[model samples]
Target: MADNTSRIVYEMTISHAEFFRTLPAVMGALPYVVDGSEVSALQDTRRLKINLSPEGRRNFGPIPLPVTHVELGFDGYSHEETQAFL
Candidate 1:
């Protein structure tokens, strides 16, 4: 029998702190990203621009200051699995 699964590369932008916090939760909730796809890949790149002003500092604080971008690739995910994941 031949496999009928498809691959997808999902990308999203979020806060640095939010990403770290959600990472584990997403993993626990769904193992697709964590379990590893046929050629699963992940990339995290922190925003280069940083606000040094007092207001910026006060609003975002220290830990959650920068913006983070994530890219994930999932291979061999079935239609039902993808639907459930979404």
Candidate 2:
């Protein structure tokens, strides 16, 4: 078995005001978890950069990665990197 100690925590936030006024899409975004903190919005970016060492060789697949890894000043996941990540 592989060790599970390394963790990645992402966090992003927007004022309630931001989602209030500029909301033609927000009306249809409720069904999804995109309030206060979330991912997969309306944008475009194909990237999957994972660098692991021999000691950290493990599978991160079943794990639900966070969207806060995107940092800030970006939109959302308009596209996903459907590459062979194994």
Candidate 3:
């Protein structure tokens, strides 16, 4: 257990039907600032952002990771729509 190679696994199971049932409400409450073409709780490849870590430097060496904020198509649906979905 003390070895650095030790790994931890997490497993959570939710039925597909249940997953979709709550997706709309969940999406409506989370806030993201990206201007994506479409905004939905659904997993769309075009809407996701790619964040890379600042690793592997040849000169000054590595520094602390900077704070990051992810932008999205927009903040969830809206207060009214979110309430209805919930």
* lDDT on C-alpha atoms for all candidate structures: 0.36, 0.29, 0.31
Q: Residue-wise lDDT of candidate 3 within 1-86, one digit each (tens)?
A: 11111111222233334433554565564443322222233332222222222222232346432222222331233444323433
Instruction: Give the TM-score (vs. native) of candidate 1.
Output: 0.39
In angstroms, give how far residue 78 of model 3 lies from its true place. Answer: 22
Show model 1 residue runs off by greater than 4 Å. Answer: 1-13, 29-68
Best by TM-score: 1
What's the residue-level lDDT of 30 in candidate 1? 35
Using lDDT as the measure, name the better of candidate 2 and candidate 3. Answer: 3
Clashing pairs in 1: none
What's the TM for model 2?
Answer: 0.18
Q: For residues 9-51, what per-residue lDDT tens digits would candidate 2 score against the true structure?
A: 2332333344334444533533322444333333233222222
Backbone steric clashes in candidate 1, count: 0
Which residue pairs collide, candidate 3? Answer: 33-72, 34-71, 34-72
Tens digit of per-residue lDDT, candidate 1, span 20-73: 456655555333332221213222321111111111222354454443334333
Stronger candidate by lDDT (1 vs 2): 1
Residue-pair clashes, model 2: 0
